[model samples]
Target: MRMPYRVVGGTLVAALLAQLAGCGTLFWPERRGQIEGRVDPVIAVLDAIGLLFYIIPGVIAFGVDIATGAIYLPGGTHAQVDPATLRPAVQPDGTVNRARLQAILQQQLGRHLPLDDPRLIEHRGSPEQLAAYGLVPAA
Candidate 1:
């Protein structure tokens, strides 16, 4: 048995239209948890390209991504301080002095930090372990 040409054509058209829409949501479904944040530039560019080629599909893409929360960057707070710079915060035992670490971080960041927050992660390691990461303990 052979399928009708109309049926095959219609199916192709529908698939193509869906393909042209919502690249962000379709491509990065894992980014769905964030409700709001800076828009991901790569995704924005892709959606804009779709918009440039076809208005309806492009608009649908943007709408779908925004609605699904896939258009925004991951939302969280994190900081990267150089291991060498943080050496002063490490104790001889390789544990960080919480108060001293907080003061160091606050001074470097020029802001108040809740280092004592139980919800935040605090790392403890041996002096040798810390040395592996370039964070040598004080003598």
Candidate 2:
């Protein structure tokens, strides 16, 4: 016998599949042009499956990230911006200057980051662009 969780999961999966099928109709024109000939039901099913698997997770993750108020940039340091000053200070060589570290932190993390939160500002990393200058993380 199937567990209760399994039954709910199966129901959710079926609902998702139905929604995907309805959505496929909207893309028929684009698919027709790409396929260049006969409309293959098998190919359409495969494409819809792939689309559902890829899009749903990506959208959920993006929504969660936004809700948490955090921005993750690839290879870039995350830092809080100073709402009052709106700048992260840098040294003459563009390294993270401890004296003007607040400004440096803002610049590295981008103006969009929440600088009002002291917790986030304190945890920011050094900018990759300035890493070669032998600069250390500010305490």
Give me the candidate number with maximum lDDT.
1
lDDT of 1 by residue, 34-116 (tens): 55679998888877766766687778788887777788888666667777778777766556787888888887777677776
Q: Report each candidate's C-alpha RMSD, comma-separated, in the order given.
A: 9.1, 15.0
TM-score of each: 0.41, 0.22
Q: Model 1 off-target regions past 4 Å? A: 1-22, 76-139
Per-residue lDDT of 1-139 in model 2, one digit per residue for the tens?
Answer: 5799899899778757654443332333223112122334543454445455677743543333333322221223334444334224544444444546545554556543344443342434556624554445343
| Weakest lDDT window of 10 consecutive positions for candidate 1 | 116-125
For all candidates, what are the clash counts? 1, 6
| Cα lDDT over the full model 2 | 0.43
What are the lDDT scores of the predictions, listed in order? 0.73, 0.43
